[model samples]
Each structure stands twice: as structure tokens, then as C-alpha cells.
Target: MATKRWWVLGCVVLVVAASALAVAQLRKRDFQAICDGAVRGGSLRYAIGDGGIKASDVDELDSELPFGRLSECRASAEDDSTGLTVAVGNLESSSLMSELSGHRDLTGLSGTSAPMGGGWPGVLTVKNKDIAYATVVLKCGRSAPHEGILVNVKQMLVEGEGNFSSDKRKRLKLAQSGAAIASDVSKKWECGSQLGGEVDRAPDDVAVNKPLPLSQATGTCRAMRPLAATAKKWGITRAASTGSDSRAPAQDCVLSNSKGDRVYRLSALYGPLEAGFRKSSSSLFQVSGKAGRKEKNPGWAWAGAKCPDGSDAALFTASSIEHSKENKRLIVGAEFETKMLGAFARDLGGRRGCDDPSLPTG
Candidate 1:
């Protein structure tokens, strides 16, 4: 009797373990499929605050924000520094945590009751000289009111998703640690990663402040920490200015993309920028919001005259430029637009990956 009982017990244990393993494998496959599908669909936005901005919230016909406006305006000709005229539209409450919670519907998501506090309502425009730039007309609690921060790359790309980055992991750790190192191992780990590969090599003759080429400033601009020579080979060439061209500022360096597009232009004083871009003078954007808007006109007399599409490309260019007064500070820029703009024919042909427009922002 004892031997028979032992045999039964062993069989039961094996069966339970096998069931668990099968379930785990199935779950892994499901998640992997979901992630892969999302990426291949070009639905991934490099957003920070919002997992992603949804098509429902961004479509031209849909009402995504509680308050929205659309306007056509021009930059003041007399005061060139008055900058661009902004058309504020589609001001609504968007939740970053909700989008990241894996719940596509804001109503179904947990924490809907949480307050958004003070970010200004989003705006839109179909015309402007510069790409989407936020001007903080209001303040969020005590934060700055005239600056816009690029906090939602995911929303820009995949509209309803989250960005997964190595820096984000470090940030989570720092938040949990209350700004203190829990152990020596943690400090060592961070130091090793920071100084690994490139920083360990030739420490001399590297252009610390040299601006990167704009074309290369897409989502893949790597720093020159590994090899100064390797970095030099990847910069923009035509960026060098002539002595008589005093109007064109001398660049410490220029940013370029794989296609050799000059995505960034450098100013001797402001450092690097997307040529004509001027950061939005807004306060709510200074803390935790991102936007991209712009306008462009290449002299009408040019050959091969394609009416330069200055929308997304301008935003992409603007996002790559950064500036700061402090030497060691990490400067970041965000691009914002009321709606994604491109050739209308391609947009409707499904190349734009049209989303179900039924989702509501409220």
C-alpha cells in the first residue's frame, strides 16, 4: 500500500509541473507576437509621458481633445524674432500611465480618477514656418510656463504605446532608491556601463560640444564615446562655412542622418538646432509635455520644385537639436504636431496604417 501511494503522488507532481510549463510557454509566445506585430506595423511612438498618442486622438475628423482649435496664420514680417504664429487646437487630457497600463481604452484603464493637474490643452495647425513647437501659455503648478519638453516620443510614433529604453530602466531604479545607492555593486554597475567601450579609449582631441549632423539625428544618433576617429567619419560635410559668409554661423560639428540629410544646424551661441527651429516659449511644456509643429518654403524659383513637405521632416529635424547653458547637462528636445502630415494619397492608401478612429480621448 505504501509503495502504491508514493507512485500516485509522484505522478500528480509531474502532471502539475508539466501543466505549468506549458502555460508559461504559451504566455511568452502571445506577448512576443503582440510586440512584434506592433513594431512591424510602425505603431511604436518614442513617447515618454504618454505611452503613445492614439489615432483617434490625432485624426483630423475626430474630436480627441475636450477643447480644440484650428487656425491659419503667418509669421510677422516686421519682427522676425516674434517667431512663428501658433494655432492652438485639440486641448484635451491625456494620461501617460493609463496608456502604459496595457488598457487601450482610457475608460477601462485604472487610475482614471487621478488628476492631470496642469498641462495646457494641446493645439494644432496646418500652416507655420516652423514645425510643431509648444508655447506654454499656462503653468503647471510651479513649473516653467514657456518651455516645452519632449516627453512623449511613443505618442508621436505609435500613438498608444510606451517607450522602452535603457535610460528609462535607470530612472526607475533611481526613483525607487530615493537618489541613494543601495549598494556598491549598483554604483559599480552604473560606472562600468557609462565608461565602457568608447570613454575608455583616446580621451583627447574629442569635440565635446561639436554639434552632430541633423540628417543622422534620426532615432539612431550614437555618441562618440567609443572612437573619436569613427565619430569624425559620420559627420556632415557641407556644414563648413566660408569666411565671407559671416551670416552662417561656424559649427563645432554638424548632425547628419544615414541619407546625408543635414537634420541639424549649429549656432555658435545656441549650439545645435534644426536650422530654422525655435523652441516653443511655453511653461507646461518645460516639465512633462512634447509637441512638434512647423512650416517651410524653399524659394519658389528652385528646380525640381517639390513644394517642400515641411511637416514631419521638420519635426524630426527639430527633435534632433538641443541646447543648454551647463556644460554637463543632457539637453533633450520634443516634436509636436496637431496631426501627422504627409502625402494625402499615401495616407488613405493604408500606407499610413490607419487605426480604428472610434477611440475617444475623454
Candidate 2:
């Protein structure tokens, strides 16, 4: 009798273990499905497919289980001139929740909170003025030990008529569609724990007087002395001159490499940027300097154009603090192989801190 009882106990344990394993695998697949549907769903395609815009270059979807069974998936798509990317992930840490709460200001965005699927709440914000961008964050549900699902969607207006008022409305519509997609995905996954009430706001903590790093500015352009070697290496033997700018003083210098195939134009603008300027700046390049590409560093925001010589010219802008009371803007334009634009922008950003008094010559 005792031997028969032991055998039966072992069999029961094995059956329970197998059942748990199967459930775990199914959960993982469900998370992946949510991610895939967000990118490939017909509704998303139809939302952005209007007005001669065609979606192409849909990148491969990526999903991963990182840190304590937390699953994440991300995907991106590109249209004629605009880019869209979405990421959905299961939140597993209190620290992550705190971080999300800290960014609740929405900067320049204006929107109201709405209840999402499963009674979870979410905030949607859209920027439609001088710059066009949109963002949405949805709270799915909570799990034991305080885990949840957070969905984020970001879209950038790369190409459109410069008119912001009309463009803003169009961007808002797209943003709403994105939020709907996130809600649907949240429901499908059935994340536990409802995020109660409206979205909360934290106090702003940015230090307006923080000093900017100046290690990159080592050469002088006024006397054309310290940069002499750089100019020589690049085959730019011409003396650096202070170019003309009427609004807020600025300095400009043009140089080219020995082959004359690569040209670099550097400009520095002095004075404070207009109010709310930073808030409206597009976040498309916030992740990677290039839209539709992921990189290791937060690069300068930039745009590119094709030059007459069959080379590509790219322009980038970086903001810095000259001192406690003053702020400066640096703009660099380089003509080089399209693939080298990001590296060139980083190089220019490092060189903007020069101590030359002749910089920004009024």
C-alpha cells in the first residue's frame, strides 16, 4: 500500500509541472501577438494611408524577455516622409512607474485622460505647431508585487506643408488612432490590476541654470590659430571669417577636405531661444539621431538634402549653455556620404565648445 501511494504522488507532481510550463509559454506568445498586431493591423495602415502617403520599409519586429519574465516588443514603419514607431512592454518595477510619473508634464502637449480597456487610464498628448509629434501612454493592469503593462506610441511629422495649424489637426487624429491601438492590445493581453483615477502630475524639476559641458570646444577660429592643423588636414587653407547674421548674433565658417568632396559649415547662434521653443521640438530624433533607425547614443536632431555634386548634405542643431546666464545654439552642415552623417554630427557637436572670443561675432 505505501509503495502505491508514493508512485501516485510523483505522477501528480509531474502533471502539475507540465501544466504550469504550458501556461508560461502561452503567456509569452500572447505578449508577442499584441506587439505584432499593433504594427500589422489593418486599422493602423488605413489611418496613415491617406493623402498620397504609402507605407513602405516595414522593419522586422523585435520582441524580448528581459529581466524577470518581462516581455517587450517594438516595431517601426516609414511613409514617404514621415516615420512612426510603437513599443509595448510589461512593467515589472516600481522604479519604472516612478520614471513614467516624472514625465507626465507632456511638455507642450494638451490632452485629457480617458479610461482604457480593463478600466485602466491613459494620457494622450499631441504637438501640432511649428513641430509635429504625438505620444500616448496607456496603463494596462497590475500584477502581484506591482507589475503592469505600459504602451507608448510616438510619431514624427517629417514631411508636410509647413502650416502647423492644419497639420496639427491631422497629427491629432493619428495620435488618437495610436491610443486606440494601444487600448486594444492591452485588452487582448488582459493585464491584471487596474490603474485607478486620472493621470497624476509631478512637479517640474529641470534646472534652468545648469552649465553646459565645454570639453569639445578646443580650437579658436577668430585668429585662425588653434584650428590651423584641422584646416590643413581638411585642406581648408582659407582663413576663418565671421559670417553675417542679423537676428541674435552668429558666426559661420566653411571648410572642405583635401579632395573637396566633403564640406563642413559651422554656425553658432548666441542668445536665449524663444519661450516654449524647446517644448515644441520634435522627439523623433530623441531616440536616435536618425528616424527609423535605433542607435546607441542620443544624437543631435538633423535633416538632410542632396547636394548638386551627387553628395548628400546634412544639417544638425545642438543646444548648449555658454555660461550660467547665457544659452547658445550650434548648427552644423556637412556634405558627405549619407551613411557618415550621424558620425559627422557627433564630431561637430563635440567641437562647438571652442573658447574663441570671436565666436558669434555680431
Candidate 3:
């Protein structure tokens, strides 16, 4: 009798806890909620704060959504001086992201991107000429399938927005505002991930920055410095790089020839982007799912990293344009492509805190 009574009590507790969680999730937010949560500091004039703007004011524009979620969300300031938009879904589902209207892959967007940097695995794109947006991806433990719950939040700020005089000023407010909505959605949605503290400012992106001499390259980009002689044969020397932080979902290093043309490209891809890259990039990516592929015809090599636990591993690739072109004296020698591949694979995996990428013995 005592054993049965304890089991009944345990069941009741679990049921109550589950019910409370469900209720919290059911109280969903509309555009107004996005406004209220955009910047807790009341900095955004049109975002549920000062200037007589409130989230409730924006909710008036949207209907109560089912499950308290919208297929897509957008918030804009009066006079069109400022605007913000967001999309939430599994990172693997590209269809949902496409609905955001000008949002596709990060590479397709024209802007400089750098890590969000406050214990957040994301990037902020400051549009100099065309479209600009900030994107962050968070992984919640097993909330979604094989990968954790991945939510991408992008915030774009126009020049006329509050105090946004230059890209620097705009980035600061953009970080705070975007992080605010991301935090709210992650917690309210109960993705079971740790949300970090406040965000202060945006950091500079090294990858999008101007190319540096091979000798001056730092972090993961330094992996290729030892091969400068080999690259020189193909007229490749300078490198454009991203930060070395493994927490970032995406990272890149592009080797360019003296004339400022791409000679080789190297990258580290994680989560939602892993599949998209393989599909859109050259046919060489197909081998990324396995031990990696090597080819002398195209002068390319790719290596796949092993992730912790049972999750999918990160993918690394090195491809060169001039290496394969017909040039007896200037072309890259056979198997040297793999040398660059191995160098990048090993270096990138070390930086990202993953096991060494898979490579066949020479």
C-alpha cells in the first residue's frame, strides 16, 4: 500500500509540472510582444517603450495567433525610419527562413558579419551598401530532432533609427535588441538551453575584413601560412578570415591571389547550414558527409569533423579555382590539395573543440 501511494504522488507532481509548462507556453505573444521584448532598455523608439509606443500598441495590428505563434513576425517604426523582422523554426528547415523576404544564406546577404560575442553563437551583419541583418543560432538540448532546438534571430537597422548615426552605433543597439527577442523566445518556448547574461556591443568581423598577408594571418587562417610556397605556385597568398571561436555556427577563410581573385576557400559549417552548403556549393561537398573527398581534376579536398556525443559533425572543405586550370608550370601539384585540406581540417577542428576531422592516411 505504501509503495502504490508514493507512485501516485510522483505521477501527480509530474502532471502538475507539465501542465504549468504548457500553460506558460500557451500565453503566446503577437507583434506587440516582440516590441516589448525588443529592447528592455527602451532604446528603440517604436519598440514598446518611450515615444508613446507600447507592445500593446503593435498587438493591435496582429490577430491572436494559434499556439501564440506567427508563421513570421515583423515590426516597423512609424515614418519607416526603422524596421525589424524575425523568423523562428528548426534550423534545418530552409523553407521557413525563405519566408522572411530578402533573407536566405548569410553569404547571399551583402554586409559585413561578425560574432555576436556575449556567450552567443551567432553573427551580426552590418550592411554597408545593400541588405543588412543580425543572425544568432542557439541550440537547446534535444528540443528538435538530432540537433537541438535551433532558432535564428536576425535584426536589421536602418540609418534613420534611433541614434544610429553610423554602422558602429547601429550595431550596438542591434545587438541588444536582437538578443532581447531571442532570449524571450528561447525561454518562453522552453527549449531547455542556458541563456547567458546581457549583451553590450558588437565585435568587429575579421573574416569580412580586408585581406591580410599570409604572414600576418592569425587564428585559423594561420593554418595556410606554412603552405605559402605551395600557394605561391598558384599565385595565392593573402587571406580573408573569420574569428577562431568554435561557438560560432559559421566560419571561413578565403585565400586570394595577388590580383585579388579567389584561389582557395576553406570553411567550417555547423547545424542548419551543413546541409544547405553541401547542396548549393560545388559537387565536391557530397563527400562531406563521410570521411571526405579528394580530387586532382578539380584540385579540391574536404574533411568532416566528429562532433561530441552522437550529434552530426561539422564539415570542412578546401577548393581552388586556379589549381585545376590547365597550367603545367603554375598549377598545383597532385595530392598537395589534400595537404591544404588536412591542414585546414586539423586546425579548424582544434579551434572548434571538436575531434580531429576524418582523413585517410597518406
Per-model CA lDDT versus the true structure:
0.20, 0.32, 0.54
Query: RMSD in angstroms, candidate 1?
Result: 22.6
Give the RMSD in angstroms, all C-alphas superposed, for model 2.
22.1
Task: Give the poorly placed runs of model 2, Cα more than 4 Å off.
Answer: 1-34, 38-40, 51-79, 93-120, 125-146, 161-166, 192-362
Per-prediction TM-score to the true structure, in the order listed: 0.20, 0.32, 0.66
lDDT of 3 by residue, 23-107 (tens): 5444322224553343232333323223222222234345222222323355555445555655555545433332221123333
- lDDT leader: 3
Question: Which TM-score value belongs to model 1?
Answer: 0.20
Q: Give the winner by TM-score: 1 or 2.
A: 2
Over 97-193, each residue of candidate 2 has an lDDT whose tens digit, in order, gives 2122222222111211112212223322233333322223333333433234445444455555233334434444444545455555555566443
lDDT of 1 by residue, 1-362 (tens): 99999999999999999988887565334322111111110111111121121221233344222332221111221212221222222112212211211112111111111001111111111011111122111112223231211111111112222221212332221112111111111132222211111111111101122333422321112221222333344332222111111111111223333444433322110111111122222211121112222223210000000112221111111112322233121122111111111111112212213321111011
* RMSD of candidates 1 onward, in order: 22.6, 22.1, 15.8
Task: Give the winner by TM-score.
Answer: 3
Clashing residue pairs in candidate 3 are 207-241
Q: Rank order by TM-score, top first? A: 3, 2, 1
